[model samples]
Target: MARMPSFLKPPKKIAKRQLELRAQLWPDLNEGDLWSRHTHDGFSTIPSTMALIMSIMDDLSKNKPVSSTYLELWNRSFDEGFATLAKAREIAFHSGFSSERAERTWKDRLKILHNLEFINLQSGASGPASYALILNPYKVIQKHHERKTRGMREDKYNALVARAIELGDISLRPADPSPPPTPMAPPAAPFTFPLPAGSAVPPSPAAVPSAPVPPTGVPTSESSKV
Candidate 1:
């Protein structure tokens, strides 16, 4: 077995030292109205690969930069794996689409995001893009790379892949294919009434009783009458 190289190891000690130096240099940095996830009531986890993801989105969208719009959506998301995009005008306004066509512009960017597979849209009472399921950007980019999608910059994709590798991010890998469904057992035969224990065949029907004949004396009317 070979030992790992020191250069390839993480710089934990250096990072600690840097943090100490930063604290010394700016004592007030952690004080007074600062928002920290530890003390904050509302916060959402954002991916560190967001910059690269945005670059890829811009490339795919051809000059129309949708990164800001994406950020708005991410900001509104509460880490619930999905977001309600019912407030389209508000989101668009925050994303710098405050013109008369603000919502329209926002919707166009959303469509681009959907086409790139960064998010899955579902229509609801709100509108066409009433809800959005945020996808793992790493996986989406990996798929695009595999497909050699048009407008994708190779260098950016390469960097994303390298970053994912460094971070030990397995999200870029394809999901396991689901197993095939188990075949159902054949249906049981139709039910039938069972015969008696000893009898091989079903019992025969009883004979019908015939009408009784008239008495001999009572038949005199037919013999002497008329």
Candidate 2:
């Protein structure tokens, strides 16, 4: 029987999961979204650091349950659009995040996801940590680029690694797509407040009485003294 060398130990299940999560979370990281200056900062500096943030964002995007502690932050400050924190938590607590640091983990991951446009940051007194889940732009660009560049006869991709020369670096960031149009709701039907039946409508501004005059023969001087 052959024994495994201590130097080449078997990898943990979490490592594979973490990698899978990252691939799903950020298929194409955009230059615009990357915090180059702050990239080296915090726990995210770990090799798979950005993946963790993407996992958290992915969880939120799926409309899953979240830690109540973190949900409290959104309830008081962040907007999740239609779904409340409590409602989200019910789905989340049942789905996963049963661990202790579940809440703190979310808070930390969200901090790294700060540049996401729809996420609102809470500053000043009684601050709460929360983020709004929006569509990831990086993934969209990759799909579009692939569609346009597909079927090209680029022989370099299959050439020997040592001899292969690649073209310009692909850009992850794309121009912000225009937001969806919000329905106008027909101007709310002009908000007509019903008047009592058979009652005469009040006079228009033109017919309303003008400013009143002082009583005839009233002495302004004597009135002021009294």
Candidate 3:
């Protein structure tokens, strides 16, 4: 039996997955709700790149778990969308650029995607080179949509609270009516004797004077003051 050479050994299983993804298309994908966020995030600046990426998305539709897309970037033939290179050249002409320029502009947006960590450029041995699509834009845009939805919900909840306060619907119900406030006890009058209808009352008694203390161990005359 002949042993297989190292070069003849098949690449890893993930390599096959990448090859498969390069051939599929996602039919039910929706981005209508995400367009506003796309505009907000300024992904609209690179029309050429946008076109190229969307074409890649159409071809790469497997939508694996986000972890599967960490291959750095993805490559595509310039003719991914068009039937042939001639047609791509025609479209490029209509877009006011040569086929090479349009291709260059689209690939050059790798600079924009670099900071975003979306894709990284790679060179090929021959033919057109490709880049690895680090993250799925669809997934990122989906997260943006999720955040936007949460924000809207929070705003709605806040508005409801504000309206409740405005209409004075405070405390859910009316709060039991507060018991009646506990009746206060009346203050007492100063201690005094009352007079009868025909009898007069006695005057208040005067305080008695205290006697002075005598001098201790002193011989005193009767005339000396103590």
Task: Give the number of the best model, judged by lDDT.
Answer: 1
Worst 10 residues of 1 by lDDT: 31-40
Q: If both were scored by lDDT, which would come out higher, candidate 2 or candidate 3?
A: 2
Q: Model 1 reaches what TM-score against the true structure? A: 0.68
Candidate 3, residue 218: the lDDT equals 61
Q: 187-211, model 3: which lDDT tens digit per residue?
A: 8888977777898667889999997
How do all the candidates rank in terms of TM-score, highest first? Answer: 1, 2, 3
**Distance from true location, Cα of 186 in model 2, Å:** 39
Q: Please, what are the lDDT tens digits per residue for candidate 1 over residues 50-162? A: 88888898887778888888878888887677889888899899988988999999999999889889889999999889998888887878788888888788999888878
Better of 1 and 2 by lDDT: 1
lDDT of 2 by residue, 105-130 (tens): 55554453343322444443324542
The weakest ten consecutive residues by lDDT in model 2 span: 156-165
lDDT for residue 48 in candidate 1, whole number 0-100: 79
> Quick one: ranking by lDDT, best first?
1, 2, 3
**Total clashes, candidate 3?**
8
Off by over 4 Å in 3: 1-100, 126-129, 142-226
Q: For model 2, what is the error of residue 97's alpha carbon versus the real structure, in angstroms, after optimal superposition?
A: 1.7
